[model samples]
Target: EAAVTQSPRNKVAVTGGKVTLSCNQTNNHNNMYWYRQDTGHGLRLIHYSYGAGSTEKGDIPDGYKASRPSQENFSLILELATPSQTSVYFCASGDLGGPNQDTQYFGPGTRLLVL
Candidate 1:
């Protein structure tokens, strides 16, 4: 089974503060992604990595960045956070997927609030 877990399920931060969201997967998947979900916008990808030691920007990578130091872990970094960045973030993973990539499994979610 594909399992993804995210840390600090909820967070509160101040403007200009730094926040880090962590994700860990036991599926040992080759592909992992970080996305933010907001009203009307659906889930938009922030970053993704194919495997360890690699990372790539996604549609909404402006205020966020990602790191994949190993096959089982990925982290999202928010630098100088802003209220605009406040939203529910999700982490997902897939194993050698193609057309069925839609089967990616998501973590519960991380609600981030910037005060």
Candidate 2:
């Protein structure tokens, strides 16, 4: 089974401050993703990586950056936090299959508050 976990279940940041969220996966899956869940926006992908040392931008990559230094770790970086960035962040992991690999499992979530 795939297992992904995130740090600092909750966070509070001042506007314009830098915030970093970390993720770690025990599964050896090749795909790792970061998503933010908001009231009406739903879960929007912020970044993802196929494998170690490979970070790719996702649907809502603006105002966010990602790092994947190893297969077991991924990090999301917010250089200048904003009120608009306050949301619930989730880390997910799954193996990419050929034409059918789309199962994604999510972590509990990290609530970020920007003031």
Candidate 3:
């Protein structure tokens, strides 16, 4: 089974402060993604990586940065967090091919509050 974990399950930050959300996966999947889940907008992709040393911008990459330092680690960075950026963030890992090709295993989630 795929295993994924996130740090600081909940957080509180001030406006314009820096915040970082981290994720780690033991599945060794080649693709990793960062997303934010909001009430109306739903799950919106923030960033993703094909593998280590590769970070690609997603639909809503304006205020966030992503890093994949190794096969098991991926991080989402908010240089200057804002109130509008507060939401539940998720991390997922998947492979390009296999029985679970289109399936992504996700972490529990990290809730952030920007005041």
Candidate 4:
């Protein structure tokens, strides 16, 4: 089956540090997204890109950034990582299969821990 995967499945960071989560999708989809899964709010969109060389900040853009240099790769950058930012991050790639329906194939996830 087609899938999305993340690297450094687990991470530990100091109070003021930098962390980057990598993602790669092989499905050849046109859109890529980054999200954080946390309690209470569930999943929240942090960033997304359409095709290659284009990225947009999603709902929550504070303390985070994103890059989409090509169709198959997208990266999430945390300039100044903080403890509150610790959470499970996910990446997804997808395309609209039907009218008003966009199917996003998600990566397993990257777990991050901040001190």
Give me candidate 2's TM-score against the actual structure: 0.93
TM-score of each prediction: 0.93, 0.93, 0.97, 0.93
Report every candidate's CA lDDT: 0.92, 0.92, 0.94, 0.90
- True-structure Cα RMSD, model 1: 1.9
Candidate topping lDDT: 3
Across 1-115, the per-residue lDDT of candidate 1 in tens digits comes to: 4378999899999999999999999976898999999999999999999999999999989988899999999999998999999999999998676666647878888999999
Per-residue lDDT tens digits for candidate 2, residues 12-107, read 999999999999989777999999999888999999999999999999999999999999999999999999999999999888785447888788
| Candidate order, lDDT descending | 3, 2, 1, 4
Name the lDDT of candidate 2.
Answer: 0.92
CA error at residue 87 for candidate 4, angstroms: 0.4
Best by TM-score: 3
TM-score of 4: 0.93
Q: What is the lDDT of residue 58 in candidate 2?
A: 96
The candidate, 1 or 4, that scores higher on lDDT is 1
lDDT accuracy of residue 13 in candidate 2: 99
State the local distance difference test value for candidate 1: 0.92
